[model samples]
Target chain A: MGPITENHLPRGLKLLLILAACRGPEPQIPIDPTRSLTLQTDWKFTSPFSGLFYDYYRNENLIFSGDLRTNLILRVFNHAGDSQYDIPLKAVLDTLEDINSCALFAPDSLFVMEVHSPRYAIVDKQGRVCRVSSLAHALCPEPGNRYEVSGYSNGIASNGRSLFMSAAWWGDCDNTGWDPSISRFQYIQRYHLEGARKCRIAKIKLDPDGSKVHFGGCNILPHLTDVPRFSYSGMERVLLNGKLFLFSPVAPYILQLDTGTLNVVHRIPIDFLNGPAAFFPPPITEENLQNGGDLVSKPSIAGLAYDTSSGYYVVAVLHEVPIDTPEGENHLDRPWSLIVLDQTFTKVAEHIIPGKLYRPNHLLSTTAGVYVHRNIPGRAGVVGPKTFHRIILP
Target chain B: MMRKVIIWSVFAVSCVPGSQDARLSRYLQEQIGLTERQFPKAIVVVSEDGCPHCDRAFADLVRPRTSLRDCLFLIRIDGTTVDLHGFMVETQNVRFDDDRSFKKLAS
Candidate 1:
């Protein structure tokens, strides 16, 4: 065979070469089944409001409270469910309104997104403010920018140096308020930790007819039925090793984005079992709600996490139950499940949570199992510590 | 006598919402059994489906004046856990949108 040259390469060989050149660095971490640990916390987070974000960092569970109504604080607890420290964030951020969500990254840093403004703050583990930066400048740099950043950011992820957030920029702003239907752009933005803006990496398409399927809302005004109350059109993301994985609420596949160029590398399809009807929630309408429909959301990917030990991607799904079904009484009663996908993006095991005893929004993928919150915080009639149940695949 | 006159004057002026949302005004009149004279100047709606912090922010902004006759707090009760953190009380100004009438009207 002649020495392979760029022009003389076969079609398959050329394609492989191009793919190899474009592919980002993939980190291979050993998965140890024995390293999996079951976690439960005794901290009773009975705050009257809901807006806390949870994550596992360095074998310790971190809970950040950013509800506008409550005192902003970061509560750290050990694996034994004992409180280590509760650091107040209101003073740290010097803002009374509060943050929407937070991402805890390497070297013990927290990237917090604000609820009332287009800004973010970096703070240390001790609740000391490291730097405060403007996302408006990074995102909407155009003069007299029409795209207004919504008050709430859905999810955040960081790869130590760059902070990423699922943010929405709406151009339809008027006296009425910001409209989600006419949202100009939805992006997973990347910003430098020091305050410099990076690239507007991923642009997520807004589903025009998604209002009925996705619980839609405008950030400014409340009490309008046509407007609803919550509208977050961003993807949940996880930055593992060197690759970025994104799970959109409306998309059926998880996208792997190249970290440096911010381009889509691979699309991992999620095969939701149709027979069991697990992790699949059918869409409903306003008429259904008027006719005693209990839930308004379609099946959505609530969160995504990666288990370095097992090389499994755990996707948390919220299932929408029919109104006639008994489980449709409350959102918390709706079924949720953890779908485990192997390194090759093949479905391994799907565990449907047996009862309506846990919150589907919170989940941590571990070697032992996926740890999920037992109950939603601030829920009425729920008492005791914030507990988590491990879902071991059968 | 002076205090009573001032109180009456305030009530008369604040009987109607200064800038009422047309749909909400209609909803209050048609669904909630509220007369035109009973119209509130401001309305705060709370639901579990929405941002909890926004709801609390609204509640905190209106807590000092929650007893005002011109302000109304509508708590959606159906298919939601409407917790106002003790800010809601049994008063004429506060009522549950139990049947989701406002929800239906708004949607």
Candidate 2:
């Protein structure tokens, strides 16, 4: 064939090149045929804590079930569906207070953070506590009196032997009570698998006017609200392209932070396909409250998973309006939905699970399948012990 | 036996037409200050077997919210706490632990 000229090129090819130049480089997402496999069983148990979400970590021999309540990591066989194993998580000295977030260094070594206690623990698979570090230790270089630790570690992610943790420091340093200003100074710390702090990244201080602080290397920018109402949760590291994809539930935004400088490389705004304001629950009127109905807004993006095959991010989002119910009164009525997004985090397709499936607490992808834990009544807290449904998505 | 009869009597009285629903509405209103208009279109009342308070709470306190009849009425028997799963299934005419489906009871 003769050399093609610009004049002979199709109209679409020219348009694509012009757009690509402006947008710069993006991750390539592959398209694959869809398939799903469901595991049967609705294991139920009441949680000592309030939330019913848990993390599922598996190795060749065992699958460890960790909850946000107790430090106990229930161990079961990899193939044991709906059956409890004989071995329980080994006990450590420092209680795994807030089992909300956990990172496994290997099959045996793990890091657990207590979001409420603001404490960190490195424990072996046998459950022996290797090291316990408190936020007070970092804040006070010289301590005349030891500060009480809160053990509330919201997010935990690992990079080989080193673990990264997000800490929320609440209460006044002196009184140790809830102080709005005190919470603004949240920190992201890197530690050895044994729980020793290597380096810490402090949150950018907000201006007096409450404007965002623009620090160069911080993943959470200064402009972001640090008030208790706006703190993030469930920070996990996605090791792809030598970059860490951090998922924060507070600003409820996903941030891509550079591991070296600890600076945010990109911020992907996450919201329901319908605008954020549009999905928010209607204001709670006296009528709704009295009727025991709560006007609850669906979360824009709650649980996120990376699909390696498609190079797309699959997020578990609240697709329906949460039923209006009294606070503390559980409403097991809403349907959970999942949305698949391309590299830019723009939604690709929305998948609403067909029936009432209670509340979904966590979403994780494994070689075996895509596991999602549903919050069943009497189930363990946010990191509930029960494995409600295992959806082997194709 | 006598205590059981008394408990059974209370349960029976609580289930009398609209008594359960009325008492529940009143209790919610009094404690949480919920008005009849503010009641949910559906409410799942969870209880265990042999607990007189839970029975009374459901029958007398929860059943009266007919104003919110649009709201669903579900009785979730605690299989962990009681053996009422079979009894609940038969009486409520629903499946036992069908987490896949939520059937609305016919008025």
What are the chain B TM-scores of all models?
0.55, 0.27
What is the lDDT for A90 in model 1?
65
Model 2: residue A151 alpha-carbon error in angstroms: 9.0
TM-score of 2: 0.49
Query: lDDT per residue, candidate 2, A266-374, as tens digits?
Result: 8776665464411322223334434312324344444556544556666655544545533233322444456667877687776665323433435445434445554
Tens-place lDDT digits, model 2, residues B1-107: 53454355446434536755666566446643457676543344434445544454444443344234334344444433322322233222121323212222211
Clashes found in each candidate (C-alpha, N, C closer than 3 A): 3, 54
Taking the candidates in order, what DockQ does each have? Answer: 0.03, 0.07
Looking at model 1 chain A, report the run of 10 residues with the lowest lDDT sum.
A187-196
Model 1: per-residue lDDT, tens digit, A1-394?
Answer: 8886888878899999899999986532122233333222222332212122334345433433232223355555444344556555665547424556565554356655666565556677777886766544334434322233332323455444554444444432232253455532221111111111112233221222220111111121111113221222344566654567766554566778776555667777765545221222122333433332232444566666666556777777767556454323445556666678787878888766543666566655433345666654332323234555654443
User: What is the CA-based DockQ of model 1?
Assistant: 0.03
How do all models score by TM-score? 0.55, 0.49
Against the unseen true structure, what C-alpha lDDT does each candidate score?
0.48, 0.41
For candidate 2 chain A, the 10 contiguous residues with the lowest summed lDDT are A189-198
Docking quality of model 2: it rates as incorrect
**Model 2 Cα shift for residue B67 (angstroms):** 38
